[model samples]
Target: MTDLASFPELLAGYFEIPIDEPGAKAVSDPYGSVRVDVGVIRQEVRSPGYLVSGLVYDVSTGLVESVVAPTQVPTG
Candidate 1:
């Protein structure tokens, strides 16, 4: 509901990592209640030549409720 400006700080606290070290790759809490996946794509023809993305999943519901990328963030 907010913006990416606050995402790193939030993720860091939830994962107990440094703000600059969210380790945004595939990660989940010890209890498996929350899961996060960071995705990257590379293409020579693309505008930026690459892309970075993230997804937050609810393990219990097996649903992806949030998605974030360098350009946008959409929640369900």
Candidate 2:
């Protein structure tokens, strides 16, 4: 995992699903209440809305598989 020590420059943003609570099981989750990891934990002051190039990680894993980039369009 990359060091988030620099912040903003290292880890720009984060976002997540609106589950009932953190670590809430998805079994009871509604359709739109699900989202991937790295919820907007930080933001870049300089870039405004641009997510810092590469600053994300999965806490729910011992080894991450992939990162699903946010899309302007939602999936069906």
Indicate the TM-score of model 1.
0.28
Spell out the clash pairs found in candidate 1: none
RMSD of 1: 11.5
- Candidate 2 yields a Cα-based lDDT of 0.31
Expressed as tens digits, the lDDT of each residue in 7-65 for candidate 2 is 33222232233432333322222221223222332221333444422222446665543
Model 1: residues with Cα > 4 Å off, grouped in runs: 1-48, 70-76
Model 1, 1-76: lDDT tens per residue? Answer: 1233357777777767788876453333421222233322322224443445545656688987545544432222
TM-score for candidate 2, please give it.
Answer: 0.19
TM agreement with the true structure for every prediction: 0.28, 0.19
Which pairs, if any, clash in model 2?
A: 14-39, 14-40, 14-41, 15-38, 15-39, 15-40
